[model samples]
Target: MRFDSVPMPTAVQARPRDSRGYPVPAITPWEGAEPQFALTDYGRSADCARGRLCSVCNELMPRGPVWRVVGGTESAAIAEALEAGRPYRNLAPTMEGPGHRACMLYASMVCPYLARPNARRGRTADGESELTSHLVRGTARGGRGAVVGFADYEFAITATQVLFRFLDVVEFLPHADADEHLGDLEAELARRQPR
Candidate 1:
């Protein structure tokens, strides 16, 4: 609940102001790589206002449990765990930030790779899907808004969502899907696995 892992950057230290005392542009914690997907136009408010914008609704990510989609190699692991209905805890995987539950649910419903079996199974021009999909939940590391980096997080899983701690790290591994609602995910995985 408390995010003591990474100290919040002071206003002068992180969000410097101009002559008018207006906050300058806010920089994302992920300086190296940007999230490939953009669910909302004002998602940057999470970085600029630090908790005033929701990644899903383009509103504020709110001060409570926020749901963020996962990418990267860890996404594959989390995706597998989700399909298998396994309990994933203390897994500090990287994420963009939080969003409203309604907004996130909408994403899960419309997202091609996340919701559609065909899109998830279809290969791209290079003969691969070229996308890793995951849905994770998180809370502010210490404050009421977003976090600055991945290291400032801890992870947990529930039947409905995956909750993250403010700060913690863990290894990622592949998982399986046992949910029947996933459609042909299992069959699709079987088809993709190397013989």
Candidate 2:
């Protein structure tokens, strides 16, 4: 299927609102090599029940719930790992988790500009480049370190290895550019949808 002409639903453009209909602000996206705080902190800011916040511009996130794509036993395993409080990395290898694979694939597909090492140079938001200094090293307890990449916000392969976490809470500058990119994505998806 051709994924090149679907329209983004208007709902995707709906700004998150409080009871009063005012916009809520998200925490600013990370700005340096070493994280200003824990990874969970960033996760909380982006995903907390309070509301969707942009990690980059510190603005309210545009409304659209995460669209999870999981298949087969991998889906069940991720849920199980989350419930067990065991790290996901321990389970990823066993299932060859499709969710993990999908996340990486999606990242590579959607942000082709980021896949090239040299492409990332000088790509900064507020003086912070696209890359984060926090490298995923071997875990002290067990399992491998979760690798994370950022284009707008933090995207990480969770330690559990069961899920690929994408934290796209940043407001890209040149709003028109972002809208254009979204239009392109929507068009692509529509093209892929079966007739």
Candidate 3:
């Protein structure tokens, strides 16, 4: 995928790119000098949520209806609704923070594990993805992740994690297509429908 093709928000544009030219997410942890994509910097994450900052860019959001990439068991219903192109009411506390729609879109397309539906998250020798700031992360629970939007969110900070409760919800929409696979996915979806 051409990294330049990703529609970057202003803050995302300022981020340093990796060897492949993909912008490193603002909250990804740095181990020594390199980024460990598998880990989240909890301090920065909380700050982003608390300060109304974009999770992807780590800068203050300029608008409402924050978008987030939600996955795993908790996001099942929302994911299903999005795939079928319907709206959903979110009554659950969102565990992750807010991000710009464009930043989240860029991430969903550029991150291989996220872009490819069944791609496995690589693990290290000790059964973790990576260890620099290793937290006990769970594998994808057979559900494809979705980019959801919420007008506002309130923090539910605990000693271990930060969560968000979305207010004034919008469609909990999933990806129409991973940008890199647009052509193939469009054809594939069309093939499944009765003509």
lDDT by residue (tens digit), candidate 1, 53-159: 54444444434454443333345544455578774432443333444433333333334343332334232111112121333222111111111122333433333
- lDDT string for model 3 (1-195, tens) is 555665555667798776667677877767776777765677877888778888788777876678776654435776666678776656665445778766676677767656655545654212222222222344432455666667777887667566667664474545434574444334534553468
- What would you estimate as the lDDT of candidate 3? 0.62
Winning candidate number (lDDT): 3
The TM-score measured for candidate 3 stands at 0.70
Candidate scoring better on TM-score of 1 and 3: 3
Query: For residues 1-195, could you state the per-residue lDDT of candidate 2 as single tens digits?
Result: 111222322322242433433222232123342332112243444243234333322334344423222222333444455567643332222111111112222322322122222222223222222222312322111211122222222233343222224332111111111223344444545664568
Clashing pairs in 3: none
Q: Compute each candidate's TM-score over C-alphas.
A: 0.34, 0.23, 0.70
Each candidate's lDDT (Cα)?
A: 0.33, 0.29, 0.62
- For candidate 1, the C-alpha RMSD (Å) to the true structure equals 18.4
Worst 10 residues of 1 by lDDT: 139-148
Q: After aligning candidate 1 to the native by TM-score, how far in Å is the CA of 9 from where it should be?
A: 32
Show model 1 residue runs off by greater than 4 Å.
1-49, 70-87, 90-92, 120-195
List candidate 2 stretches off by more than 4 Å: 1-117, 121-184, 187-195
